[model samples]
Target: MSAALKIGFENPVAQSQAVFRAVMMALARPGTVRRLDVPVDAVPALDPAAAAVALALCDYETPVWLDPALAADLQVQEFLRFHTGAPVTEARALASFAFVPLGGEVPALDDFAQGSLDYPDRSTTLVVAVEALAEGEGWRLTGPGVAGEGRFIARPLPADMLDRLQRNHALFPRGVDLVLTCGDRFAAIPRSTQVDA
Candidate 1:
């Protein structure tokens, strides 16, 4: 928890570990959205796991973008600034990392990164903190990491997100990566995962 702030009654170290576990499970399961535990020990707009992510990932070298709706909260922003020394930027142009709060309109999937043909790894990532996460009637996912093809839905995702992600896969190693977080749970779906609607 290097230089991370103590949000509230919750332990920052414990929260960070929980997030790590959630992301690991999500990458393994693909389309399945898992639930994270949110202890009522923090302030509004700052979920325990979300705060943990700021602690774990953000640093001077990593630029982060949170939804503007949350920008008004100097407490949250200052906490991030003091703890991570992360640069904040606009949604569409955010480079490496993003933290999207709930209630605002979700951005177009392409707003982040889809990588590139030669350097697919250069794409940006969005750390969307959703209201809740659960399995839904989403497009079936079947690819390198999946055991078999299956239908998986997560929201609130963009209307054209699936299509854009498909196109992103055409670039392969160059497409953007994602981290979907809710409560204390999160999952990372790298560009390598193939999505078919």
Candidate 2:
């Protein structure tokens, strides 16, 4: 194996708590941007926020699926294994979580684990690394979390992302959730959220 990349929280327990809280808040209030504060240098081929999320949420019990570029990077693989102990999977449908980089052709929503009507929580959670994440005009989100409507803007999303998300929402309690990451910030879009582009 290649030399493991240096990346992980300086104070693993405390940092993980902070990251978890941020992620929880983001998921609770879908489309609300939140910052993740972890004391770790950025790893090559992985976004800082994405790395933070992995360290916060993944463990031996979780199966992670890396996108093509990340899967080819030994440094990232080693770093994740050493720090998170999360196993990597070759099957997208079996992944508990998936890391998808920006500027690539995102995999089809159906390619991932959509869970089942009886156990919707078993669906995969997507951590999408984007070039930028902001609150503005692009997609209008409305659901349980939003007081009225939530607006989120991320550049260079998949051409059919909105349509796909809509379809996913239609699946009700059986679709995947999404977490958009950029640098040290992120936002969530649960499967229950309604997306209008």
> Who wins the lDDT comparison?
2
Q: How well does model 1 score by local distance difference test?
A: 0.67
Backbone clash count, each prediction separately: 8, 0
Whole-model lDDT per candidate: 0.67, 0.87
Candidate 1 lDDT, 83-148, residue by residue in tens: 678887764555677777766665666677555667666667767776655555667777766777
**What lDDT does candidate 1 reach at residue 180?**
69
lDDT, residue 127, candidate 1: 75
Which regions in candidate 1 have their CA more than 4 angstroms from the true location?
1-18, 35-43, 91-94, 113-118
Query: Which RMSD values do the candidates have, in order?
Result: 4.1, 1.3
Clashing pairs in 2: none
Candidate 2 runs further than 4 Å off? 1-4
